[model samples]
Target: MSMTITEKILAAHVDADEVRPGEIIDCRVDFVFANDITAPLAIQEFQKMDIPQVFDPDRVAFVFDHYVPSKDIASAQQCKITRDFVRAHDLPHFYDIGRSGIAHVLLAEEGFVGPGDVFVGADSHTCNQGALGAFATGVGSSDLAAAMALGRLWLRVPETVKYVLRGKLQPWVTGKDLILAIIGRIGVDGARYGAMEFAGEALAHLSMDERFSITNMAVEAGAKNGIMEPDDVTLAWFRPRARRSSAMYRSDPDANYADVRDIDASALETVVSVPSSPGNVVPVREVAGVKVDQCFIGTCTNGRIEDLRMAATVLAGRKVHAETRLLVIPATPRIYRQALEEGLIQIFLDAGGAISTSTCGPCIGGHMGVLAEGEVCVSTSSRNFIGRMGHRQSQVYLSNAGVAAASAVLGRLAHPDEVVRAPVPV
Candidate 1:
């Protein structure tokens, strides 16, 4: 009868005290969301259903992130559609370029999500919100449409994969490195359709930003969700920001798990995923001399304030290679301002790096840093499928902020320790 965190949370939403994996359940939705890229389609479908009104305006959110500045007429039209929909529905949670952050980051910082809530977003990375102990996942536009009109949705409960993390991470090793090692060991799709529940002493040492990076990429492994149960760390991050307080939930001590992975956090090394697949990973040493044309540190994956600080530590006074382009993007406007106030922006500029507006720009290869034919890059963003960032022949090596900073300096793949420390300009 014991249940995991995902099971316990879903059970409450459906009036059950406990539910087993694979059970079909009709559940109440705590929130429904879609970004500029997905919301237009969801709204069109919602209109076809003859739903004149949204279930709850306050419970619905729309963010103008992806291509928000309107890369072209098409993107501009998408933004206009989302803008009108938010206005027509009186959606209070709506956010535009100047007003909001990336959808996942903004929602979390604005107090819209909390422990034990079921949040459905129209983007795959919605699972990122699960770091707060919520059962968050990406659903298709049609699924989002129905959730918007009826305030409910159906889901087949998924089994859980428990990860017990131990030990402290070595300096320069990060959650990105830890998760990359896991994907490398298990391969992509390792946790297919299963909930990835991370726990253990190591979780205590990771900040919410670091945990967000790990959970945000759960989809790359085909996981249904990636959740970390609430603790003192979670409480501290959520208490000041949560719009609503929901009772926290935890897995039963004897909870049944589909499988359990034990990881020694200290044993991890800087890792990178080779071009085309996140699972094709290796230590930085293996690819130490591989040349890269660009380096990117942004997107929902590693574009937080903490991530920027890591890169700053590595770049402080040094300039990036003249032949390599380094693009640094903060995930949200708040993070952008904080970086500026802290002079991280100035540091990057003095080091010959380019700072961009807070948007899902080059990470999606939409703009800001598109790769040319046969080019290669080291990036902190997730997903490097064939031509994921531009030209099919162009390659991308996935790494963390530390690797990204060092790689930019050498115009090739390198580790943080390999770079000579530089002094900040006076």
Candidate 2:
């Protein structure tokens, strides 16, 4: 039987010669992750157990991302518990508020994950690491506790759904649009519990950041995870880390693909995930003229330096609409420091955008940019479920940071081309 990249990784984890899609195989997890929101409970559960030592302290990652700086008293206590656990176990990797970004981005930036590995995290977006070709997935708190106790977790090998993308995207189109359009075709649960493998010519044109934008939202499609082959761009990112961490690997050429879905990237225009759900998608032009109260750029979805640069291209020398409150958050403290050095922060501030600390912020609605009742906001965050950004009546439009920046300036749904286009190489 031919095995896809995901199946190959799962097989490697289980020490199997070959594993087929849809076949249930209990495999060991290579690493485990828990963020501030879930780490407290997981640690409490771990305390109930009498494990001598964690399977591998180095294999465990604890990040203070969701409630970084602790929004409230309860959140502060939760993070304190996580800090205590990390110190007690002597885990090698601990990302505090100033150092941590979104768990997914920070994971890759720090070289904690690699291809052909089976990794699990206690948060839903844990699948984001799959962009690097690792078979990463999300699990519950109990599972995290068990992984900490034994340094191993189990998984059912998932069936894979391949997306064969073709053609270069037109101006204003981005990986966010590609994934949102796919969600439209497959509906919210179309790929539920299945791995999404992106391939073909269109994928080659996508940058690592863009591929991340696709993989980060795979959970919304009900996927086990989403992955792309490691190309030169990925290698460039990995090679440096390999000098310190273990080496990384690409998917073997003979890797098998289970099902292939083709997409025309050029045909993809700007897409918007309307309020209350990621599946509520439509072309941006269709929703033009609708006014919004706020616009936010930055999240695990599209908060990298490149994403900020794209927004800066739109916001430079332009004022945000008076009625719209625009907020820009860098994904991590490192990214924030880079933006400062690159003058990106000045551009955003000059455009009347509020800069947020490197935390999840309004992406999960803890604070920073919560919307009021009946307010409409354009954002670069992952989900838009009910009350995701604030009051239940508040509406959210999900797009790339480029679109969010453009909409902030225009006070309505606007395309990236209307504000900023991909920079032409000099």
Best by TM-score: 1
Model 2 misplacement above 4 A: 243-258, 420-426
User: Judged by lDDT against the true structure, how good is candidate 2?
Assistant: 0.84
Per-residue accuracy of model 1 over 54-99 as CA lDDT, tens digit each: 8988899998888967789988998898889888877788888888
TM-score, one value per model: 0.98, 0.95
Q: List per-candidate RMSD values in Å.
A: 1.4, 2.9
For model 2, residues 147-187, the per-residue Cα lDDT tens digits are: 87876666667777789899998766888889999998898
Q: What lDDT, from 0 to 1, does candidate 1 have?
A: 0.89
The ten-residue window of minimal lDDT in model 1 covers 417-426
* lDDT (0 to 1) per candidate: 0.89, 0.84
Give the per-residue Cα lDDT of candidate 1 at 171: 83
| Highest-scoring model, lDDT | 1
* Clash-forming residue pairs, model 1: none
